[model samples]
Target: MPAAPTAAWSLAEWLAWQEQLHPKSIELGLERVRSVALRLGLLPARAVTLTIAGTNGKGSSSTLAASIYREAGYRTGLYTSPHLQRYNERVAIDGVQASDADLCHAFLAIEQARGATPLTYFEFGTLAALWLFREADVRVQVLEVGLGGRLDAVNIVDADAALITNIGLDHTDWLGDDRESIGREKAGVLRQGCPAVLVERHPPESVLAVAEDLQVPLLRLGRDYDFSPRDAAWRWQGPSGALDELPLPALPGAMQLQNASGVLALVETLRGKLPVTPAAIAAALRSLQLPGRLQRVGACLLDVGHNAEAAEVLAEHLRSLRPAGRVLLVLGMLADKPVEAFARLLQPLVSRAFLGGLPGARGLDAPVLQARLRSLGMETEACRDIPEALRRALAQAAPEDLVVVTGSFVTVAAALDVLHE
Candidate 1:
């Protein structure tokens, strides 16, 4: 085995070392991670745990849940994956990103405990977050599953409540090919007798079967819980009661309502232990901020929507906005994603596309994306990278036009760096 990182090592050095520590970057199984957690005594976290799993809205839903708990005066921890800018974004306490010194300490602890066992980059991060959360003495922890829930590193903790925020066809290679198989994998987060919330009105049978077989107290949207528009505000009705005149979520898009409703249901299940008031819910919705989800900066909008489902939602949101001028797109995607299908979904709304090359082995090149868009009969320009794409798109866009930056998280991160500069 390679030498472990020392206490003096920086967070960036530790992260770089971890990326090459394991044989496979993404070997999805619990045995290795669970064993490490046992050694670290991170199992059975003292805090109330809410594990969120889904292809699309896991980030938004997890953020919403954690914000509500924090607003209710709890020291909350949130762990999410594929961060846009920095590694620190993965583990947050009370809405603040974990500090480099804290993360380095956590990494050292895990390094000393793991002996000869090898851990993937993601596994190391997950264990580190759990250790930090435990040390912080958080009252609640919201864990967003890194991949399919069954064996995702975050699933090591049997959560008090599990929320599946509408599964779709994503990570098909690792999870499965179809929605049924994907749903089954996501459903693995649900524990027996624990409450599970489903945001999808008509979830796949596989998800429902797992809940039924486990005898999970399921709260499903449109059945057990639902949301409706009330003027500029909205109302959420769940098994417990109704929360009326709630402010629309600060997160844009109609899909946020679906995510908010499921979060409300999950919050209701934990009321006995957490006890979040209606005011906290309203406050959280009005103030919560999630980066790169239709996030607007002047005339440019940035979203990390890489798949067909996300594309559909983005298209819907764009239509609702009704931009006075054409919608210009800057897109970069991983090689594994369904670029053609994703592009087709937004083809009608997009007047022109500026394609760019993403980094890493999985990132698709700009020329490849150009060919895909051309096949769809859409006008396209291929840029060397996302920053160039954003620049060219912005330079060409009229004042009334909306410039959209999207595809993978990496794409949006690059655009954000340029915008900040």
Candidate 2:
């Protein structure tokens, strides 16, 4: 049962209360949220909304989209999930997190409107973000779907344009087990006749089928729009036109170029309505930042690549780096993840591995992870916590060697906390 508040509750209080509101952390269907949204009159919005859904790259895509819109002089509202540190990080207006007071106010409004209805923590936050966006009078809103697009809370509002960055096997317990099923679930964000960008060069048939069924003008990678690397920079060509000599993405890795291409395709799709300048696009590309996806902090390289597809992308980045010394991996993952497959993908690159305990009910403890890795014929060291694992990795690391903290967002968040401390 949800806790009752007396007098005034702080943002933290509201968040804590919200956690206990629902029995399950994630209930994917949207009826409860849709009803609440209807009651609050949040449907049929003002802003030109861009909803992004993917197994990976959703954060990068959303960040790039918001920054591009901001550089174009539009007031942008960006809502992303699983904040690394602060809850404020989830809701950003013009690149600034919403203030505590503002979040509290939004929560209060939602509480008043919801009545007897219950909402998950994510659902509550989604509603609050939408409310905040509306109140801020944002010209454009970029929403990252928390889970599968079809029934995700963020899917309540129909998008003016949408992007499904890539369909990979993830959240299989909730979404189906195959790429085709996952692709169809993500393609739910596509609105009829809306310009939808499919970033995957080889997208699942179900995704394409959805786009075709809904009459969506789908711009696909290696099909409708494409990018090519030129040393440090890249070039993109799409239906609207071509952009040459574009700067390499501020975010590192080969995967980001693909993400940037999708973002550009989306920008081109909404060009008639938004009309961003080339200069703004260039500036945004060079300046955009998302915290956890392959962020380099001092000597440590942190990534939140937990699943097989993300692990493969991380492998690509590692192989590209080809460090002189060695790549020491400090890893922590949730219990439900495909640990064996994830560990096996990077086995060739990782010289040694440090497994750490993760918190929460779904956490896979260090011993289990260490056993899993060792069983795969990799050298493994088990540690009590993220800090301990990182400390061990750093102690053993040579100056030329790299220490990668990865596996899950929780893992990266913990590593970051220790790094900051």
The parts of candidate 1 lying over 4 Å away from their true place are 1-3
Whole-model lDDT values for every prediction:
0.93, 0.92
Q: Estimate the TM-score of every prediction.
A: 0.98, 0.98
**Candidate 2 weakest ten by summed lDDT:** 1-10
Candidate 1 residue pairs in clash (backbone atoms < 3 Å): none
Cand. 1 TM to true fold: 0.98
Q: Hey, what RMSD does candidate 2 come out at? A: 1.3
Q: lDDT at 42 for candidate 1? A: 93
